[model samples]
Target: MGKTTGFMEYDRKTAEERDPRTRIGDWNEYQLPMAEAELRKQGARCMDCGTPFCHTGILIDGKDSGCPLYNLIPEWNDLVYRGRWKEALERLLHTNNFPEFTGRVCPAPCEGACTVAINDPAVAIKSIEREIIDRGFAEGWIVPEPPQTRTGKRVAIIGSGPAGLAAADQLNRAGHTVSVYERDDRIGGLLMYGIPNMKLEKSLVDRRVNLLREEGIAFVTNTEIGNDITMEQLQNDYDAVIVCTGAQKHRELPIEGRKLDGIHLAMPYLTQSTKALLDANYEANINATGKDVIVIGGGDTGADCVATALRQRCNSVVQFGRHPRQPDERSEDNPWPEYPFVFTLDYAYEEATAQFGRDPRQYSIITKRIVGDENGHVKELHTVEAEKIPAENGGYTFRDIPGSEKVWPTQLVLLAIGFEGAEDSILVGSDLEHKRRKVKAEYGQYTTNLEGVFAAGDVRRGQSLIVWAIHEGREAARECDRYLMGTTRLP
Candidate 1:
């Protein structure tokens, strides 16, 4: 939908990042701005394939295949290629509630499924998207547009993460009085605290939140639903209650010495670091300065831990991943139209590599146990290198090699394994049905057993991408509006 032969003429380019060595000193965003001409060239890389799968918004074999938000990717790419910035912004905002957040954090399945990716590099959709929204804000084209009429229906969304925020935005625009409740003192949940500031600046989150407030969404911070207020109270006051609390119950490693003093979950560590940056009077409870750190997981969270430890001036850092390294190119099992499983260096890893003179990730490693000093602080970590074995169920499992046992000295251990699901504490004394530790609700319906209560995002779907959370939030808002007004115009 861009130039007729643009895909053949132009090469794919992405936003350049700040120098890793210098950027590690602070918490500022790492990505540098791309020039308009280059960004337009990136937009022009979009091909005129008859079936554009970039916005298919589907999951193939339980993996994200395209933009879950179903963004009008080709249309906006064409607009950007033509220098129609305002039109591009309109198209972008038409589907995405917060382009800025998704542009920065979303693992763009759209690019993985791009038609151009079949034979060549994919279009730089994420980079173009970030530029469009950033330019829109800079040009004063983006502003608060509160609904003119109120429906007299109220919605209470629990959680200020991407999902909750998206639902609130949609409901508020549909003329419903929406109040977002966050347990944390700040408005944004995962955006504000779960993620580090270097990846997504707190100011950007504050900017959008301020805009949301101007557009008539009430925000209640430092309030817990079941504690500060009761579920019954919200049900009585609001027409609908949407549970977007997210899957915050972090998975734990139950190995020996897990209860050591220096060991911590990844979220709490990230939260404390961010809190310290925001509050001058506060100091981070867990400091890694001059200490040997070992992160036990290889996901984005683990990489963030590695980066954070480096910024804290740790003596040395290493990350352990259960899975082996991914291939440089897509494997046979992972084909086109599915999110490509390939190895690429993320921002955090780049920074760690630059600072340490080597990558901090150690693959195919399983932690046997932690060893504590006499004072009960982490003193060493025992691990074993494992190999992946094909299981009878067509899945893979790890088996430890007998002679690969090793030990590493460390003072701090961070577990970034993953999340289990929604916290059990959030559901206490409530009749909410749960499946696999997640709130039970159908995907499109999003309704709970209760008449007026609904659930969405990670709370309902388990741990997923930010784009999927936004998609669920928007869909849930539509369903809630329909239940309230007997009809809904929300897309």
Candidate 2:
């Protein structure tokens, strides 16, 4: 509340982006940062609402609404408006551990739940968030706030993704020596390898990791729980164990020609593409250069695949989805204050439309089979229109329409149907039992069948957002701390 009338005085503004035609030529960040003055104006737009619903991280209609990390949105916005950036960074760091990562990649739920969004555009929360953290890094304000005293308790957090990192951060702040074990060659787990670099620069991830290392946190890389060091040994070594290994298993297309050479799971394809871009693809690289590519599933992962493929210079690219295209306007059933189920173009779609002369999305379509060449390579894809019938339960049922089959030239087929759960190989090897393939832990507690072992993040709750992962990790940290010490104070 720098100015009493600031919300009315300023229009919401955000980061700009280069057009697809120009940005697709290089594998760099397309989201252009907003000028400082504009960012300040956007920050000033935060009204001094007495009950700021933006930070009220509560459940809405059974869905996790608002900021899961409960960021001090209005406080920081006002601080930025008053030119007190350092103070704003402190407020921002009050809850969130990594604002830099969420600032870039997260589809901000806070803005969606903003109180100002009743009629006007929502405040540019994400942009201001990114600016605050970047300012912290540039001004050297970000430091490792290691715990003051040791509790003589040890904890092992498997998987260094958002969840594992948050759990470790909280436990470390509680004066417990935390050791993060990552199966990957590097830390940050999905943030390090799964996500494309352009959307979120790896430098930001590395910067936080470096700071964590400076704080005396021991990071053991390439050491899996069941494989490298058996879970039995982990329990014997540590007082408590937290399973934060995210869901790595991908859903598959159980159709003909599924064993074709050019077909790949979304995670592997995305992971390989990121590796090629950073590590430089070698002899047998999975390059989409000058190839016809079709990405299945029209979610963010699919869009990321399209963007990555375009950057790799794919000749033609398209994405297909099974459900009917969403409507442009929200229906009466979906009134205000609810997450709108309206069709809107995302960044990837915008880029593809600009580069490829049309939107890459084809809705209400289902892939029947993968048409492959004689030598066991995917050549083309066969698809059919999915007809919909209104469901008595207030939804719709899909049926394969007749005489609507078609094929698209596809040298590469990336399946992005989303992940199911974490790989059970390690869990089973650890002799941990599970419910629905997830670690069978009682609600409100992350305890597993094996004593002194717990699970969190996608591994515990299935595939979820980074914010939820962070929350679960923090909660699990408290439980683990309480288990080690009869009483705990860390939150």
Candidate 3:
């Protein structure tokens, strides 16, 4: 829907990032904005394929294939290409509640599934989306639009993550009185603290949250539903409760020296670091300064740990991953429209390489145990080189190689192994049915065992992407609206 021949004429380009060496010195956003002319050119790269899979929002091989929020990529790209920034922003806001967050953090499965990506580089849809929203804000087009009328229905959303915020926004727009509860002292659950400020500036989160406040959504911070307020009181206070507390129970490493000092979970470390930064303390509770750091795991969390360690001025850093390095290009089993299983340097790796003279990732490595000093603090990390072996059930497992065990000196270890599920505390007093440690609510319906109670996001679906969380939140809000009003009009 963009310029007819633009896809063939212009090459795909994205926003340039600040130099890794320079950006690591502080906790500011690393990405530098793309010029309006270049952004329009990137937007023009959207091809007019008969079937645009960029927004299909489907799963292929258990991987995200496109925009989980089903964003109007083509329409917005066309609008951006035609210089209709306002129209593009409107179309973008129709699907995504927070493009600023996704644009900066989401892995951009939409680009991976883009039609243009079949033969060449994909359109820079994420960058164009961010520009539209940023421009909207700059032009003062984005503002609080509280519902003119109230339906007298009340919905209490638990959690202030993207999911909870999205649900609150949609429910509030539906003329329902919505109150969001966050256990933390501030709003924006993961957005406020779990993520480091370098990835997403907290001010941006506060900006949107302030807009939501003006839009008539009541936000109650430092209030835990099951603790500060019981489920009974919550049920009596609101017509419905949507749980979006997220999968926060981190997976533990129950090996030797597990309880040693100087080892911490990844989320708490990130949270403390960001909290300290926001509080102007400029010192994290789990400071990595002048220490040898070892990160156990891979993916975004591990990478973030590596970057945070570097920013904290750690002496050295290394990350362990059980899996082998990915191939330079997609393999036969990984075809088009399936999120490409290929290797590319992430921002954290770039910063680590720039600072340390090499990438910090050590693949095909398994942590055998943690060795502590006499003081009971972490002194060394024991590991062994491993290889992936296919199991009888068609799954894969790692096998440690003989005579490959080694010990690396380290004072701190960060476990980014991932999360198990939602914390059980939230479900203690309620009879909410659960499976696989997550709330057992069907995807579309989002209804729990208790009447007038709902669930969504990571708490309901297990650990997932921010985009998926927003999608579930929007859908759950729609379903809740239907239940509240009988007939619904929410999209």
Candidate 4:
């Protein structure tokens, strides 16, 4: 409990956002800082409940019900309310390895499960977490604390994403000589290249990487394990190996004109943009400048593509979702305390509406084909309207509406339809068991079929949130430590 009557005395107030029109001109993070006093008031809004569900991570109806990291939401909220930011940061770090990353990008399932959210707005947990970490860095309270002694044991972590980074951090803290290998030129894996700078600035990732380096954790970039090096070499060089290679296999659309010049996958486009930004080169081969862009897919990646195209000064933009639009409010089946599948305006949606004077999303639409010009470049996209067909079994299917075809002239098409699983190249000769495209490992054990080899994050659990990746990474590191030292003192 933050305050006896704090919930009744204060209302939730989150950080302000930069104007969408102006923010679309730059790649920097668009969120403005929240005043310390105002943030304290928001923290005071946390209710005194017997059992706060916000910190209980559970899966209900195949959806997240609370924070996956099992963050100490009430403790931190009370700390923030009492102006104990240093203590709040310490509490946040107890469960989450990187509050900066999750505070910026995580969808905040904790808020949905808040007891107060049943009737009123949830506590601003994510904003408070972000503020605590940012203040810690600004005040120089966050410093690299290397282990006291070396254990003479070495561990190798593949894929430098959140999961790999979390594992590396834990293993290094346990006095083990840890080395992380990344195929990308820079560390931070997807954090470095996958996400756009607007949502999460690159400088933040670089800052953490520098701290990790100063703490004696070795980072090897531009060297992949299975390709540049071999699995046998990894096994021979290290005491144990943990594969955190995330699911990078992008789903593709096998429709007409799929091989056109102007059509590209979302990851490559986003990666190229970030790389070009870092290298001070704006002329990317897959740029969307002066083109009419059509982004297919309705997930976060698709929204990111739309925002990128807008920043690139595309002439026009449109997004398509295969399923119909959801209700503005929660439906009967989606009750409180469960992640609500409702329609909400995201940053890209707001920007598109502001710039174009209308929402760019067209629900219940399916792309039939991609039309190309004589130059063999994407020129237009053909789509058909979808109609919902109800069945007696309380299920439904989508049927294409007849005579509802439409086409739009466009030059760039980005497929942001999500990912399947880990790439096959890395797992080609590995004697690891798998389910579907993901490596098979028990939830808590994190052990693969092969001895001394483990898998975690999206590679084992499929596509998931950054918090889950961090949790898996930490758990996998503990298992690896136990395997090497016969026991682990790590949390």
**lDDT, model 2, position 307:** 89
Residue 491's lDDT within candidate 2 is 67
Tens digits of lDDT, candidate 1, 123-208: 99999999999999999999999999999999999999999999999999999999999999999998999889998999999999
* Worst-scoring 10-residue span by lDDT in model 4: 425-434
Sequence-dependent TM-score of model 2: 0.95
Every model's TM-score: 0.99, 0.95, 0.99, 0.98
Candidate 4 lDDT, 1-491, residue by residue in tens: 68878778888888899999999999989888899998888888888889899989888977888988899999999998899999999999899988889989988999999998888888888899899999999999999999999999999999899999999999999999999999989999889999999999999999999999999999998997767898888988898999999999999899988999999999999999999999985567899899999999998999999999999999999999988899988889998789778898898999999899988898999899988889998899999999988878888888999999998999999999999998886667476788788999999999988779899999998999898899999999999999999999987
Say which prediction, candidate 1 or candidate 4, comes out ahead on lDDT: 1
Query: What RMSD, rounded to one decimal, does every model reach?
Result: 0.8, 1.8, 1.0, 1.4
Off by over 4 Å in 2: 281-284, 390-395
Q: Which digits, one per residue and each the tens of the lDDT, describe model 2 over residues 1-491?
A: 65678779988878888877898887787788778788889888887777777777666665556787889898899888888999999999888889999899887778877767867778899999999999898898877767678878888889999999998988888888889999877899989888888888888788898888777678999888888898989899999999989888888889998899988877777777776666754332476889998999988899999988888889988999988889877677665555556798887888888887899999999898888888989999999999888999987888999999998988988899988787866667788887666777764688888889988888888887888888788888888888888878866
Between 1 and 2, whose lDDT is larger?
A: 1
Model 3 agreement with the true structure over 151-256: per-residue lDDT tens digits: 9999999999999999999999999999999999999999888888998999999999999999999999999877888877889988999999999999999999
